[model samples]
Target: PEEQFEPDPSKKNLVILGTGWGAVSLIKKLDTENYNVIVISPRNYFLFTPLLPSCTTGTVEHRSIMEPIRSITRHKQAAVKYYEAEATKIDPERKVIMMDDNSDVKGTANKTEVPYDMLVVSVGAENATFGIPGVKEHSCFLKEIGDAQQIRKKIMDCVETATFKGQSPEEVERLLHMVVVGGGPTGVEFAGELQDFFDQDIKKWIPEISDKFKVTLIEALPNVLPMFSKQLIDYTESTFKEEKITIMTKTAVKKVTDKTVEAEATGPDGKKTVEVMPYGLLVWATGNAVRPVVKDLMSQIPAQKDSRRGLAVNEYLVVQGTKDIWATGDCAVAGYAPTAQVASQEGAFLARLFNTMAKSEAIESQIHELSSTLNLKPGNPGEIATAIEAHEKQLRRIKDIKPFHYTHQGSMAYIGSERAVADVSWLNGNFATGGGLTYLFWRSAYLSMCFSTRNRVLVVVDWLKSKAFGRDVSRE
Candidate 1:
């Protein structure tokens, strides 16, 4: 017989899955006095994802931007339970979740059953490949800290190998050519950082490579940074041209193979041409794909038919066709853009609403007991209905929790060491893009948002070291 794990009956168990922006924000705001909270995620720390591009070039250390879950949990009223595990199945009927401790996806290893009174699923999205060949096998990703480290190692490897004792020009060119797919903020930012490194450090130390070292950014769309305003987008394109970074717009990668990538592009003659370009390092930033576990959960629900993104949720962030189970962030289609800002806001909102519902329930119970003990006015229909209606109104309010909406706090992207793009709002319907002064503001803003004082200091140190001595070129 399997181990029978029982729910903690001492307190209401609230289990939240995922450690992304949404889960972290929710855990931070929830009043732990109302329940026993449990956070389950594969990652033990919450990552500040916006500044990840700098990490690849060692401009910012990975640890400086990561905050441990324990630190945030300690802020709660009660001792919150944390399980570094993946939730495989959510059995709403049994009020239990099937989770496993094995690294990656579990196969033969036994799974554990943990019951919960309330569940929040914020397990985020995965890298979306869109069935494009050669992507999973050859390209590197930029979604995690490990990915950054790998890219850094690859950069060093590219520079070292190309400049090796007696390598041919063709081989060196191939080795130095870094190809980045998808022209979103991530790809653009990464390419910008890579170019900066080559211009500032590699050129100074390893001059033999010359201008053969190139970075190419490919976007299927007509322009890069589609989410930004026209002014900012134009600014980025102009900056890329000035920086000599290749922008291959209107080009879609059909297949990525080791040594070369096969792509189709429309030419100036309105005809299509197939091109193959040899590359050294490839970064795939084609947004996110659905993780297997999330897909399995969505498949179980029929109402999730129209919900191709992820689990469909009601206004309360509750997964449709279930009760006492809620989800947020990228994992579920919360009817908002899958961004760090949106996810965090949804999590915090859920926390506040959860606190109110709990208090309302307690008050309702007290009123019921008082009415029964007093035994007064059994014929008062208005009082009875009104009493029931008031709390019922509370329940409706909880149910009527509005669907998540994304708040655009403006857009900012790091183009190089001292340049950035900001599509921000100003007074009286004014918006502008000024690189010089805006660059400083961007640096200061990100520095202020670091996880802690220690993180702030560490990031500052990385920046100063990079500015003074230049980046460390050692691969290891």
Candidate 2:
């Protein structure tokens, strides 16, 4: 439809933002022959975020769980055009998005405005810092593959510094202490993986510094894993206790300095007292926040005033403020939790809708042939038959064009080696949460979810190697 590049002038221009679960699902589901699909995001690859925690300990290499956007749309119905750039702003009136390729180490500057007949925003959330001072500067976020790599390096750096003979005892103690805030799935999982690495690898190679290393998990709530049932939460606490890892609950982190975290907690006598804990490394997995680009888009529309989190959307996943634009995942307050399942479902639904709209004439052509079979005798046959036949056929194909519905498959998290907790309903009835064997189930499930068979085989090999000769202890 555009001036320069229209292989087919009849094809509608469909632009999708972000390569997260939702956007990818949308791209996969759309019947591409009817529309020119373009995907734009800062990241070029789709991250299997659930297995991301394991990457911090080198158990799962970052590349294993990552699938290039081009690979996903490869065998799909339509080959989606991918742009490695971030959408800066949305001009609703002009039906255009301003995007710029983020360049630092990578030298690529293909920034341009992309016009769209239909738009989908699945821009995911960023790690929330909550305006906490020094957190952004000092804390390591576990949202992306790069963040996991930095954490791996920082963990080794702390160990190396702590064992250096010339350093002071106080400095060494700080270096040996690993502190994690927010006892959510990510925080708890990270703490578990770190301890696994130290126990399995670091303890054997550098036995001299083994006893000095410690891990502490702090949560502002009274108990960790709030999403799980009471028994599961208790089980996790007991497991952590047995592993000798510290679990501090009801602890509020006030601020974070270079090597210490200032916090406040209530005493046994019901008195609040401030405490400072020294740390070698701090991981702030306190969940997500709306990105600045999303905020700017939200502020532009008056109908989006009540939607503080991001753009509000109707059941059809269409943005409430505008007719053509739709939003999915964390960027939209879609009456669904910001989870991968919901995002993926929304994407699939959008694809079906676009496909149906594109092939409606085909369906009408099918209906026109059956028009003679109708027993209704009427003077205005053409007008009556058009409405009557469309309604009858729509009933049969309702599933192909209905609004999005999310099916919660429950949650699963790996605590440590041969240890996990799952709240699954697919098997074991409803609300099945346990550790030990369940951890194996978690591992196998995630391994099977790998983007490619190549990644799956490599991951299986890594696990087997670790089992045969312990973990790789080399810092580099």
Candidate 3:
């Protein structure tokens, strides 16, 4: 008979926060048999963020990229518990996390405390608004599934309103103008997808207003994709130019109104002047900011007072000045870019470290038992000595856990018109590629990186469907 999967009361309770790239990646690689695993997050699903931009324009459906967290927990050797709640406060002294059920369907036990022997805080960052006026009120964020759905709906709404009878040409142009702030990957990819949608579907369905449709990418920095190689950045800019997407570099958006974005635009002669641009849709993707939960935890720890970006973590990924609590992904200041690649790698590393720690504890227990037996019965000293020696060797091997080291694979981005750019690590150095072939590589790479085969299949289907049948423009 096979042993059924159940949580052992003797094992330590391991609680993890958030279901983002970091937490989910850790769960995927974790050995649950050693610990009583309990996951808590507001979202019940793990969202594949790479293809998230495609969802905004319906190039790919949002559900296709999201894998249910329950699906992951079900496959573990030991039965894992999941709570769909937001972690509000962390009492590190008591080793308890105060969580609240933020869902619509809430019960009497909506708020409670979950105690853990070891805690993993991977609660990812939120959108950064830089305290800009009207940003949060008027801009659509490119972070979650709801945000994508909202953008898609807003796109169609703008198109439909532009084609409305007796609408002025100026109004139509304003309505068709889609402004994207932040020249980072999210903003760039979304701009690409928005253009592709216009070229592919909107041009055929609503040709009258297609020519009026325009995308303007606003960046405070001198260039877009500052993280990518200069060559790749130039390639992206050229591709955007060819696609008729306006690139506004060295422009800082100061305020955003219902129909206008106020910004300081720098000209070729280093001249700066205020420009108020009209737009129907505004997508804010300026990058990440520390979440409130992380800030709260940081405030509780005196050592993390200087941590401005996020929680200050040591080289081992352990929270500095805190015991038994680890952090990964965007929540931790681990001297790495808050990309999915880094988060996933960090999650996997934590899993390995935890497994090693569990094994070491087991070995120590066995050695203690053996020593006690030898003390009780001195006649069987030979067998006891051999067992102790073997256990000691295993303990030594278990304790030799190497520190986490991040391996940068590379970075790639889609730049629309069936073109992409890549800065990949090849052999002992870096290899930069751009244009058509790189787009295919980009597609293949993202597909392979999807959380599951189900997600990959659904995403491929979505792509094929969008190519053959076109995006469904029905407002829901």
On lDDT, the leading prediction is 3
- Model 1, span 1-476: residue lDDT tens: 22223344766889998998889989888997787788888899999898899989887878888888888787666678888888888777788888888677556754788788988888898998899998999999999999999999998998898888889889998999999999999999999999999898889998878778899999989899998888888888888888889999999999999878888998878789999999999999989777787787777777777778888888778889887778888887877778887788889888987887787778677668646744776677677667766766776666565655556666788877478998775553546575867889888988886667877898888889989999888888
lDDT to native, each model: 0.84, 0.83, 0.94
Off by over 4 Å in 3: 1-7
Residue-level lDDT of model 2, residues 1-476, one tens digit each, is 21233335677788899999889888877787788888899898898898788888887778877888877777665566778888998888898989987856555556779898889989999988889999999999999998999898899889888888798988888999999999999999998898898888889888988778899999998999998888888888988887778999989899999989998997778789899999999999888899888888878888888887777899888888789999888888888878787888888888888777767755665566556544445567777677766766784675356676777788887777569998887764777677878988888888876767977887888788777787665566
Candidate 3 per-residue lDDT over residues 305-391, each given as its tens digit: 899999889988999979999999999999999999999999999999999999999999999999999999999899999999999
Query: Whose TM-score is higher: candidate 2's or candidate 3's?
Result: 3
Give the Å shift of residue 265 in candidate 3. Answer: 1.8
State which candidate, 2 or 3, has the greater lDDT. 3
Cα TM-score per model: 0.90, 0.90, 0.98
Error of 3 at 71 (Å): 0.8
Q: Which residue runs of candidate 2 sit more than 4 Å off their true CA positions? A: 1-7, 105-110, 268-270, 361-400
C-alpha displacement of 333 in model 3, angstroms? Answer: 0.8
Model 2: per-residue Cα lDDT at residue 459: 82
Candidate 3 deviation (Cα RMSD): 1.6
* Model 1: lowest-lDDT 10 consecutive positions: 1-10
Backbone clash count for every predicted candidate, in the order shown: 4, 0, 0
